[model samples]
Target: MTKQIEESYQLAKQRYAEIGVDTEQVLADLEKVKLSIHSWQGDDIHGFLFPNQELTGGIGVSGNYPGVATTPDQLSNDLSKALSLIPGKHKVQLHAIYAVTDQPKDLDQLEPSDFKYWVDWAKKEGVGLDMNGTFFSHPMLKDGFTLASPDKEVRDFWIEHGKRSRAIANYFGEELGQQSVNNFWIPDGYKDNPIDKLTPRLRLIDSLDEIIKQPYAEKNTIEAFEGKLFGTGVESYTVGSHEFYANYALTREKLWTIDAGHFHPTEDVSDKFSAFTPFGKGLMLHVSRPVRWDSDHVVILDDALIRMMRSLVRDDLLGQTNIGLDFFDATINRIAAWVIGTRATQKALLMGMLAPIKHLKEVEINHDLTERLMLTEELKSYPFGAVWDEFCVRNNVPVGTEWLKEVQTYEKDVLLKR
Candidate 1:
């Protein structure tokens, strides 16, 4: 099988080379792209801090697939298994609530010491770490609001949480030798049309300004704001709309996260990448599949994903973006969900990298309309899969459906017992 994969890769490499695409270099480049794999998927967003508490602030993980990790160690174990199947060393994204500590702490009281277990685990696994403030699923979520709460006390608690999250993120970067993206996503919005919308937004802006008041080293941390159109409960009004953060990120010189599932079903987030990256400091992309609303489904090799990745490779916006996966599917095997989504994203990226983007752009520049259309359609038929298989092989991961067997075996041996 190895010999066959190598032979197939050689043929695919020759085909790509003929069209001015360097298959070897593409492999090398793709390997270096470290995606921030969100850890919530391993445990359905139910962090150890409040495992029994009902998920609040409009957050919900559907389906009751058994074997969800109940502890921090279990979550990390699942993540390790998923990372093994996925090619390339990557970063693991953590929320503030996932801190593995014997000492009890709230969001505001969290310190770098709380995440000592994670940092040690990351070093052993040879992966970097990313961080997020868990704004939802807590007692502080008063009346479906957090940072935008009318009550100053409620707002203050979350503000401290945000600050703590940044501190921890900076620590991760310092300890692991890579800048951590401290992403802020507050579940602050109105469930129905309120009489006044302006006050909440004003409060949110002030809360954000306070959280970022203390400057952290840019090399150690990159702060980003994520805005959602609406959520399950906050379907009527989202406080931090896309427009709000677009301006905020630009003015503050911060990264704006473009979550694929946070927009309308018909519209995808690919176009936003081109529009935002040109003006803002950079972007943090949350890759997920949205079925109808902002439903965080597992990613697939669909046209939306292909276009998103193609835009990055074609326009060379990768360096200005921090890639991350954001989806939770409790309906399937948790480990398999992580492996599937991450691998699908990598495959889409590989598809984009294998394209003769320069050749297509040259024709477009020359106004050779017919040729540009023909070549793009022709690329779909190319042996990109063979090249992708080679990528997995070279990285010492299972090719094609081989990884699924390992996942199933793991489920029977390790997960089912839990």
Candidate 2:
């Protein structure tokens, strides 16, 4: 650790101590939090399934960055580089389409054997793996629906895919000794107003019931359902809207995934955390930055991000919430994007942990509204950066912007060559 960083941390430690917050314990707790890094960020959601498959199902990558990962090995290597620069133990979230195999297999035919390479790599890196059933960007989804399709044949194909994905996720959990979150999100909606939204929703419910009915150890695989507000073509209505999934998850006692970018631009996901925690079995968060519509921008240390983390901390939902990144930007260095987004998430968590949440809550309970508001505003100016720098140092990662140099060096020597 640098002399200046240590000095700053010591001072911040004393300041937090005065507010009944243990800085050392907070740092220790921060290390325990694992943020799942998304694999799609390295390759702009382009999976190595078949040659020249167009991005379908409301999926879009906005830039033509020169060095996007073109193969499974390259994507894994890029993720490794990003993980090296970030602090804390983390997991890598993968889609069904990222499976590496000698022979081409359709989504319905995918098996755990196809992702043996990923399990081996995660074991070597000492990280966990999460899985997702890719319901988008396939020939079956060209009509802009899956699992909720009116066509019986189309719905059956996606149902089989979801079943296999859960089985693969179960394998991941048993092999890695960590619970694998198998998230289900399908871009099923109408470009214009639909004649009958109720019919599609009923079909979706039936499809999910079948998928979840497949016998797998509940301890190994966690089934999570994600909902969306709107997407590129699905502007008028989204079948799996928040209201639909919230009710479904609560009734079925399943994990509900709340993506930050999946709601209206003005809606606060943090506010929903408390509401959902009371009824749902558990929660999974897809942390992303949304501009206007559901534009997945790289997350930064913004106010919304801070508030979200603070909500988790305040509601004591951090343990129940499975945190994961869900943004992919192809305009800049992909590795850099991963580092920046992951670090920003960690930084936000640190800020929340360092806050005098107990005291703030006590004040609120006592009906001291003015003091609560004052203390909240005052805590914002605390030396959070000092604690964050110390965290990076303790994790043996570069402090401040020092990590940028490493990313730049990597781009020059590694990414630019591609």
Candidate 3:
């Protein structure tokens, strides 16, 4: 078994070498990672998912950015042609949330034909779909969901669609189950000053509870909340990491989705992952490169900070993963962008896979090294790190001169540097 493992490692080293990874350093790092990660086998987290509509180039859609806006007729044809190009069991998301179709009164206006068409596209392409909510539609939700019009009728309008979406998922069945109508990215909170308007946020959370507890929210249907730090208003409900957890705490039904670019503009990616660990909630990580304050969604992986995050999630140190490509690359082909993002993400994971074997030089900094891993006092105060560290030490992790030096140096100097 050891020989077979060594052979596999050698094969992986060769593959990395071919992909421009420094194989010698990576192989050495792989040894350390193996020691650190041995007991983490049998984990259910595996594979990836991309948006099917993204695979379709501008020719077949009606929405915004990258692709040209077309009528539904043109969108249908474009989507059909685009579906033919995809390969494998990739996770896809519905771009229909941005639809400005004729359905202002009813959000369920996106019927079985709409969903079934996407599913069929995925079926033909051998892919799966990850559904997300829309903000532009529902006419009444122009400002945001939680704080849109502050009118009960408007809130109910959105909620009614939530029910319709669940029903559509039922009609579509397993295909939809493979992904989910992932929600709770509620545009709650206020603009101007960060005060006032607490009821809307609470209402949004309650609405999420109803959505998740309904018949559609199954084990297969993993509902997720994308915690946005900004965009909707000055004070969003799920902005800070704690707020995200608090929202989830309301009901133990669903998990939290982490968008790497959604924190305070200067927030570290590694720190973000640490915040979500206390709940040990299954994470849905969105992979995208931020251009300055704006989310460019470029596919470049040069930033070491983002790469370190890639490593942590790949290592499962952050727990069960549901990583997705959240790019909105405007210049390139969307399919190519998705592929590039996935490839870069895989590369980062490979680097992390090599971390257990790398040296871990003992440092005498002012604070404990693990202190850096703590996102909040709550997560650090919890027993999470102790259990994780115990697992590492039992495996005889090296005490000094580690290759993570490369990772840390790169992250600190190149990636995190503003």
**TM-scores of the candidates in the order shown:** 0.99, 0.98, 0.62
Q: After superposition, how far is residue 404 of candidate 2 from its true place, in Å?
A: 1.1
Clashes of 3: 15
Model 3 off-target regions past 4 Å? 1-88, 98-106, 142-149, 169-173, 176-181, 194-197, 232-242, 304-309, 313-319, 357-418
- Residue-level lDDT of model 2, residues 77-125, one tens digit each, is 9998899999988999999989998898999999899999999999999
What's the lDDT for all of these models? 0.91, 0.91, 0.45
Cα lDDT of model 3 by residue, 1-418, tens digit: 3344345545655544443445455333322321011000110111011112232100112123333223333333333332322212345555434232333323546554556655665576555556555433234554444323457776666676666566555444475445453544554444555454555556666665565566653544556666666653444343223465446643564666666666676777666555665565566666666666435454565664345555474445644556665555434443334434544554455434433222122221445456434322222122222222222233333111232344345334532332
Local distance difference test, candidate 3: 0.45
Q: Positional deviation of 310 in candidate 3, in angstroms?
A: 3.8
Per-residue lDDT of candidate 1, residues 1-418 (tens digit) = 9999999999999998888889999999999899999999999888877778888887889999989999877888999999999999999999988988787778899999899999999999999999999999898998988998999999999999998999999999999999999999988887889888898899988999999999999899989999988887787898999889988999999999999988888885898888888788999999999888778899999999999998898989999999999999999999999998999999899999988888888899999999998988888999999999999988999999999999999899989999
The root-mean-square deviation over C-alpha atoms between each candidate and the true structure, in angstroms, is 0.9, 1.0, 13.5
